[model samples]
Target: MRQNPARRNALLDAAIEVLADEGSRGLTLRAVDQRAGVPTGTTSNYFSNRADLLEQLMRRVRERLTPDPAALAETLRATPSRDLVKTLMHQLVDRTRRERSSHLALLELRLEATRRPELDPTLTRFFTSDLDANVAFHLEAGLPGDRGSVLLLYLGMLGLIVDDLTVPEVLRPHGVDALVDSLVDRVFPPADHHGEEVVGQG
Candidate 1:
């Protein structure tokens, strides 16, 4: 049982690894402590119970899984708007590929959230806030899409990432980059030459 933030984060990372490999059924406090290579009952020192551990795990995963706004800003600043969308989508694909275990654990938490009604409020707030921030980001960047369109793009990316990560063959043939390009073209509709309206053939 350590009060250190580093130790706490280490435990959470261990929990993610457990969840990714063994699913929620195997995410016991003892299991987490063992996975973290800490003393027995150490998880209980930080997390009061299973629910608390899960809630904190969700928060931690959200923090790690989301895109980096500052980096995205720098990227968008250097690239054309149409290309920025592709770049961001490619980032999503890259993250899913590189962080497969974390993403899988995130999916496990999502399923657990469905069973634990008490988690809804916290999860809801997290998702709502994230969506609002994303919408604001797109608008601030002068992207050619309203919040609804932005949201669609978000969902599309999520679905693509999940499918590609879980079942790579489905997307490997066309390539994630090409699929993302098509998706961005469909949802974003690149700006016209005259800067009046979107003008891209789907």
Candidate 2:
């Protein structure tokens, strides 16, 4: 029903706002329609049911949350592997800070998926795509990280984002930058070619 991409994105944006404000239990077709300020039945016309709405919402989040190619290319060109890890962390913190609502909605989806076995495939695919893309990025940038390293870094960043958004005071005084630097140091530590300690040295 979204003959226009703008309208579709607007509705998805509305859904994210609803998820952030009202939680997953409050997300309904009617709620999305109302949140979008559209006529009744609008969301149902676009999305057949809650599952459909959630699937589209997941897709939209992926599209919106991915790193910008041009910006990433420049950063990769100018930064070393260790500094690049810090840059990635900065990007995560900045995006989470700026897009708190959307990120919150994503967290809701993760929890909701845990209770819905049918959604496991979609969730798995979504995360696998992220991991695969991350691996590709690391390879292209000559970053020090294997798939396992990506997994660990991703989990750490996800936890940091969740904490930053929910209980921000928990990370007070030290701040996100300091935490990120620590993570970068630990995740992509310095290594010599002959030294067998680093993850990506194969």
The Cα local distance difference test for each model comes to: 0.84, 0.83
TM-score against truth, every candidate: 0.88, 0.89
Clashing pairs in 2: none
Q: How many backbone clashes does candidate 1 have?
A: 0
Best by lDDT: 1
TM accuracy, model 2: 0.89
lDDT of 1 by residue, 66-145 (tens): 77779876878764476777887788788778778888987886787798878778777767887898889788878667
Q: What lDDT is reached at residue 109 by model 2?
A: 80
The runs of at least 3 residues in candidate 1 whose Cα sits more than 4 Å from the true structure, single-residue gaps closed, are: 66-70, 191-200
Task: Tell me, by TM-score, which candidate is best.
Answer: 2
Query: RMSD of model 1, in Å?
Result: 2.4
